[model samples]
Target: MASVKSKAGANNESSPYRESARAGAGSPSLVAGAASLSLNSSRAYALEDFDTIATVGTGTFGRVFLVRDKKSRGFFALKAMKIPDVIRLKQEQHVHNEKEVLTEVNHPFLIKLFWTHHDERFLYMLMDYVPGGELFSYLRSRGRFSNGTGLFYTSEIVCAIEYLHARNIVYRDLKPENILLDHDGHIRLTDFGFAKKLSDRTWTLCGTPEYLAPEVIQSKGHGRAVDWWALGVLIFEMLAGYPPFFDDNPFGIYQKILAGKLEFPRHLDFYVKDLIKKFLVIDRARRLGNMKNGADDVKRHRWFKTVDWDAVPMRRLKPPIVPKVSHEGDTSNFDVYPEDEWKKEPPVPPKDLEIFKNF
Candidate 1:
């Protein structure tokens, strides 16, 4: 097995786990170093078969890197996770769950996990590399999206989430940070660490507070319906540059969420306003616009009636703006990883055979 060592010496200022704020309770970096197991697959694996171009992002468990495959010469996002950290935090199940959910899902708007591998120290996931940056940063830079652009992205996310719900998967986390932009600027849903397959229902108080549905905060049993509530909040944020419910105090935000009040800009179009009203309804049973209606309801909304669904998915629509990469090899420009932290490798785990027994 290949040995690993932290590039950052003892006094390095760059903490790879700085993105912990975005991950909340499910940070990937925290779990990266916990598992110390190796797989017994007959197939041989080689790390040097790929070139690490740049660090795209980092989380509690590990960091994601842009790498070029030596064989296929294709670009891919390599997500590394520390095994011991994951087992220590009791998140081994969550990691398995994420892999299972991602394997079962196949949609253009959903990020695709191509392959997975693990060494004694780290588990690596190879995924489609979305060239565009995160949708959240895009929106922040643009102030707010135009109605046409917002509806286009929202409609795609609705389709993706509806597909997950239909498969009995509940995506508890829905936030701008989790939404990645494809090469064409279309929204692609990523990160299923907090997601679970719902056989019945759950009362876990997990998810971004700002995007949480009222039921989620109250610790009430919430199924896929919570996703609907979040969709409404997401759309409002996209249009207004902020979530419908917001307060500096966490308790105040919870109160606003339970109240389910929506305030729209006066100049917003009627169609957009109406869609928000239907989605923001306090009643989850009725919030998604007619219980019988599925994602089609949102797709058929008047605001999106003019959107070319086929074209949007095909990357036909011109993106509002393109990201500025410093150079052809500078994929790191779009990512937030600190360069000073990339000099050393992280520690590798000791080999253990039992780890593969459950997987």
Candidate 2:
């Protein structure tokens, strides 16, 4: 969103649903090496090559569809970005950034962008179809998660952030909606729209309000540390049933984040409390991952003492909940979507196709 660099305003309203921070249990998975190569498909897929099964999600820029490959009959999620819509939205650079980041980085915990193709009307992205749906839906259903479940998911997320930071990429957005569950229950962090590769800092005040870091709300230069802050919020919400700081308005939420006030549940463990305190530090320099030791310091914390780091990337840990998808074509996990086409565009000029030629 263009407001990434703008001040917090009424436009940044929180989703009434987003504030529903209760969560459920999940297990961890191992990570893979750096994504240094692009994907090579058997053959390039097209919009007409697949049958649209259903619309899985709608975002500011485009719509995500559950599609079946007619030739192989394999199910995949196709994220479609209409050219004229993106240009009108003024998110050209963000779209390009997402495509570039997806191509360069491949990890077990991160979503795989198989390949991209653009027609005159839209830019098409074929990605792995995560059948378990959003962690948000599961969280809302369970209200809260067990400590083991919370830690399991957090461990994988920690690995994801570690990988991104090592590559100098700051994932500005961290929320349950962006966290998809594989059929086996591992996290597949999706949507790289707000992701930016930065060695120093960028003053973009973008991110879900409840997850936004203090420095971001203050318009001070922020970096990978913002992601750590969001992680703290995520872990807390998973265990406590809600974020540590929340208010009806975005400005109010920002104010609470700046104040750094935290009211933990009395039943919470001291070690978990200590970890949250470490990451929620108002000063980005003092934040756990931002310190000299970086992510290791956070990983080595007492709360994660039982985690087997080596087994993490290998998908060895048994997840508590395996989604009940009987087949690859199951749409039972996703919310029923509206059937609006939003006015499709006819064939465009070559110049229009040039804009997304490399997508």
Candidate 3:
């Protein structure tokens, strides 16, 4: 890794990406540095500008569509969240938070939100069309990653988590499914529904059961430290092809996490073995990032010795596995979905949409 600097001079590539004038104005302190910051214009986009092709992915409150921008002939992933479902599921706050965070952040490793819109019944978020599919999918196909592959992706994730933490945001969800690979095979951390800008602490019983940190399971307030813990779990899963802690039930998973019982398989590299041990520490204060030097402590470790932090921000390092994307509008990398599940409705504003004015 490049020798750490305190951002005392020009924009540090090792730090967060530089923010544009618009982003800097909104969150001055969080705008550390970036080579090029594509701030969200928040311009109005008509439905006609985009041709929604197919459903690429879905969740409890929304579906992601492969959309082609008619004007630029570019492709994008449009996330459509039904307001009624959000309200019924009591995920309105999460929806708002996701939209707000996505708009503010612009990093190579973080998913960028192009613009957001609403048509009464649904809220729409148009973002980068990452067609390489989920990291989870890649891991599943390969079973596990080589040590070098794990180090490469893990280094990028470290930069991402550090950037979010510097911005006073805590990404509660960090797992393979939420981590998408771009066309170049670099990691793009997505799904900000569980993310929040909490500089201090927050008590939210959220995130995947297997990935939840011990502090979160305890209902004890947690902040950015939880993210580091999740990073540990993610690194372990990527190399081992499974999470360190698991059970048939959520309760059992929580118990394993609280117990902090980690059994390493044989033939693991020394750097990974030591780093995971430090990161999985149950004591939040003693955790990797929570310790004195913070994220730098983790970055400076021997495991990441080969990581070129500056190159990561500029995407100078070529990824190990670039997706075979044939064209700009390629959907071959994504899974196919049934057509019956998609719905088409008018853009008329519902009478009950007053709560979304702020968004």
Global CA lDDT of candidate 1, please?
Answer: 0.63
When 2 and 3 are scored with TM-score, the better candidate is 2
Best-to-worst ranking by TM-score: 2, 3, 1
Which regions of candidate 3 deviate over 4 angstroms?
1-39, 341-351
TM for every model, in the order presented, reads: 0.80, 0.87, 0.86
Q: Largest TM-score belongs to which candidate?
A: 2
Tens-digit lDDT track of model 1 for 215-250: 777777888887887888888888888888888776
Model 2 RMSD to the real structure?
Answer: 7.4
What is the per-residue lDDT of model 3 for residues 1-359, given as tens digits with 9 covering 90 to 100?
00111111111111111110101011011111111123375455655577767666654445667778878888877666666555655666766677678877888899888766655446666677777777777788899998998988888898898899889899877777777777788888877777898857988677777788898889888899999898889889989888899988888888999999899878678889899988999998899887888889998999988888788878887787788888766767666655454354333344547666655
RMSD of each: 6.9, 7.4, 10.3
lDDT of each: 0.63, 0.72, 0.69
| Model 2: colliding residue pairs | 29-312, 30-312, 30-313, 30-314, 31-313, 35-106
Residue 326, model 1: Cα distance from true site in angstroms: 8.6
lDDT of 2 by residue, 117-208 (tens): 66556666667777887787888899988899888999999999999999999987787777877889988788776788896888765677
Superposition TM-score, candidate 2 onto the true structure: 0.87
Order the candidate numbers by lDDT, best to worst: 2, 3, 1
